[model samples]
Target: MPEQPAGSRPTLEAVAARAGVSRATASRVVNGGAGVRQPLADKVREAVEELGYVPNQAARSLVTRQSGAVAVIIAEPEFRVFSDPFFEQQVRGISRELTANDSQLVLLWVEGPGDHDRIARYLGGGHVDGALAFSLHHDDGLPALIRDSRVPAVFGGRPGSGSGSGAAVPYVDCDNRGGARSAVRHLAGLGRERIAHIAGPRDQTSAADRADGYRDVLFDADPALTVQGGFTVDSGARAMAELLDRRPDLDAVFAANDLMAAGALRVLRERGRRVPEDVALVGFDDVAGVAEAADPPLTTVRQDIEGMGRLMVRLLMRVLSGRDGREAGAPASVIMPTELVRRASA
Candidate 1:
């Protein structure tokens, strides 16, 4: 083989010459050898190794019309994303799945409304092959922006079109309503009357579903028995306080997520409320470290947060793989199951 110049990047032509093959054939081999014969691929690889040649990723993506990267967008503030174990679990699953598939993960945080335009431009620019978005509020315009960009995307929770039309968007979410129902039923079985619900933000579907589930159990549900929370521990504590003020006789409480439940636990502890004995308590999400660490170990609804993340990436990948780079005709949205993990709190 001819000696390469000092400080010069090895070129494809040199590898092709060393391999005794056409440059196009060598290119195919270096770019994953999809149709090249095994012996020919081996030869190209050997030549590449001999020459210390590295295929330029930008040029490769241009040829394939694919970035070979996937974006994981979380529509939340940095504090919440960093503090919440739920987001951490989801991202871990996404990273694992994307890594196993030899794809890059580009994490994006939508901190403010301005980020939407920037994210839309990024998606439209073909910077990533696909996107996995999560935590959309009903009023959030992300779904519309994504649809306009024409990039295949899968959401972690059921997302509205940011318009009231409720246009279709493929997603993977757990059975939130059913899980809430189960939690309420358990509390009722404990013979706790005046059950109260601490719901999350009403604009998000998951929160809305959980709230609806609470109402399904208690038809003609007392308006005062339900208080809204922001899915944060502080919000949970505040909402719990409001519930106590409204109905001190309330015998049980159900919070939308474990974070809020943990908050409620603190408030209950402060107010001299005993867990399960004086007032039974339950929470959702069963987030690691939050539920089990609560005084008296929380009994909560468990959704596979990481599993849902993996499934979201899997679904978007399927759509990205569609023929002619178009979506594969909208594969049906998926809803994963949830469980009511029994523990000491209940």
Candidate 2:
């Protein structure tokens, strides 16, 4: 045991000298010992304890050529990122896995097209080892930019086409179309006819897929029964009003997400429509606080939002492993299952 002359921070060199091992052996032990034998690794650990040695992350990055951090790029503005519980839950999952792997999470958000240049520059700068992005739209250029930057990246949903006909980036998404079909079918089973749909913006993959599911169920129904929404409470309220104006006799409503569903519920109450009595209602995403807190608890399609985020990180780790020879294979894109949860609203 050596007492430090109270001075500067301890370095790897000091730990190596104390352990009677080369700087390289101490380096391997400090940076998660892999090829080193157990007894020698233990000796390095004891030396590190006695010397209180700390590895310099910047220097370590130069040695390993890995930043030891992962970027989480969300394409939404600041307000929506703060308001929406879906992103919150997904980020929680990502943080949990990143902590386990001793990696850092660098959060990057895009407010508009103007921010793309800054984001593109950062991705190419190698500040983080990889990135996980979501909430893509048709006009957003992140998908293509991510591809061209050649950084290991994963999408949170089924990706839209980016750039030319090159290979598709891996992604983790839920069964959005199947979930919407299940919700609409549930309403139909309850003997409600003329079910109207309040759909999300058509540009997003989730929204487009949900709209397709609604059409699949009501293929030959009147075109006026569907209205577009912006996946917001205010938009839901506005769309709900429009639907009533177009089809006052409709007996059911299916909202794309829980926030919109909550908004639609407000409009329904304002218009003096009863839930499941006059019009059966269902929504998707089963978001926390929004769904159950509705006037009557909502029966909606449930997807594993946090689980999807966690799975995205796991997939990215596999890809990183394949690149670095730690793991043997990369993963293909994943689509998780969804289910209908029965509650009072439906």
Candidate 3:
């Protein structure tokens, strides 16, 4: 036998010949594609292991037109991405679901304004199968870009109507409005009329939806008292303090999320306001850690983030398969439900 060059590498044909299978079958087996017979698949796997065959992503993409990878693009601050428990849970859910399907998850962080164009290029590059976008602001054109790409894509939450195209963007989101209502209703059940809201950023769809829920519920109740606290700890503290100053008679508060609620709780303690006694409080996204660690514990709304991740993947997979046939008017919304978790706070 002739000796190959020192740096020469094994190719798909080499593995196919060794496995006694066609190159196409070897390719399918190596790329984890379905429908391959078990014995042939095992032979290809054994051949791959013996020869140390590594499949070229470019070649695979050429044949399958799929990179066997999905991108999860998040535009939040890096600190928030790493530190937020809600984000942690979301990542876990997404990871678990994607891994089960033998697909890769690419986490892209779009930190500054400069990152937008680069993100567009990455998505347009045909290097990924699809995308799951998160943390988009009101005016960000990401939704439209993803839609126009004609690639399978799903949003983590609704992007607001700042760009007009947001209304038609396909997304998988928790029922923020309904969850917020449940939280408020629970507080109302405890006879807390002077309820205030520590809301998230108005630009975000989740924040806006949550605010709408609180507003909708409060409108039906007797005195409509409310305020907005941008979705941060400091914002919540400041907003809670201001609300207390304005309405010392306020008896309850509904923070739009658990982080904001935690902040409000700290302020209440500092101001010597008794929890549940003086002001019952409720929060959204029952982030397990903060809920358990809160001074008086917390009552919160819980959404199955893992289920959302799995469902988003399934939807995107359907889009990838061309089963639904992507069209402009094919129902651009996928809303998930939420539930209230009662505890000492409310």
Candidate 4:
């Protein structure tokens, strides 16, 4: 055979000719070596290396009816995406899992309702095989659009509607309610009464669930003890101030997430309330930097954020591969367990 010109891109035809096989056989081997014999697959691989060939993903996707990519949709403002360590850990897990499966991740940040149409169109355009969505609020219409687009999806938390009107979507979430229950229980065990809770945003299921857990423990507790927060440091600090003003004798607190806990800690210090001495404190998520960095080191409910991310991908991949056995209904959901991590704060 004549030597191919240098610097020219190698094609499937060239690789097939070099391997002494049909183009169809070479294509199968290049895609995944599924049905082709071992010896022939080896020859095709060798030929591919020799010619420095690279498969055209766009062309290959069309033939296989698969994009070999997954979308990671974060339905939050840009600030939250950058500031929240929870999202960072989850994305890391997702990236690791996708890399292991030889799939690509397409990250899409939905800033608001205005971006819904664009995101829906992109999902409907057959850009990815499935999606992993996080930080979904109740009023967000992205879920409905995702449903309409008919793309397989797995949520990072329990799926619900802001207006209470949508069907449930498959999701992988840590046990927010259970984790909160454990945190509150620990405070109770420490004999800290008048316990207050700094809850997360009411629009998200995670915050709602954690609040519910607190209510379960403090059934007859004063309603004024619970203050709403936006899961930010400033919100937590403000909420803590409000709690202190409302219930001066409150001896313990549970902040929905670590960031809020850190905020509350600062306020406690400013107010001259000693952590775990004058007042006990507990936080959730056990975020690496925030929880451990607190002056008194927060005792927190540890959720496997990365594990939840990995589990979301696994579930979505199952649905995409048609192995989930759902009989053409809603996708499956997984709830991971949470554990209480002891520290100096509580």
TM-score of each: 0.84, 0.84, 0.81, 0.82
**Predicted structure 4: lDDT:** 0.89
lDDT of 3 by residue, 1-346 (tens): 3355787878999999999999989988998999899999999999888887778878767876788899988768687788778777777788888898888998987677777777878888888998887777887676676766666787788776754442244678999999998988888888877888887887898988888898888875433355576666777788888888888888999999888899899999999999989999998888868876888998889888777777777766666665345543434568888999888988
lDDT for model 1: 0.88
TM-score of 4: 0.82
By the TM-score metric, which is better: model 2 or model 3?
2
Q: In model 1, what lDDT does residue 294 have?
A: 85
Clashes of each: 0, 0, 0, 1
Highest TM-score model number: 1
Ten-residue stretch with the least lDDT total in model 3? 323-332
Q: What residue pairs are clashing in model 3?
A: none
**Model 1 per-residue lDDT tens digits across residues 23-77:** 9999999877598988889999999998899898768777776888998888898
Sort the candidates on lDDT, descending order.
Answer: 4, 1, 2, 3
Evaluate all candidate structures by whole-model CA lDDT and list the values in order.
0.88, 0.88, 0.81, 0.89
Rank candidates, TM-score, best first: 1, 2, 4, 3
Tens digits of per-residue lDDT, candidate 2, 147-243, equal: 7777888889986654323445789999999999999899989988899999998889999999899888878878899999998999999999999
**lDDT (Cα, 0-100) at 56 in candidate 4:** 78
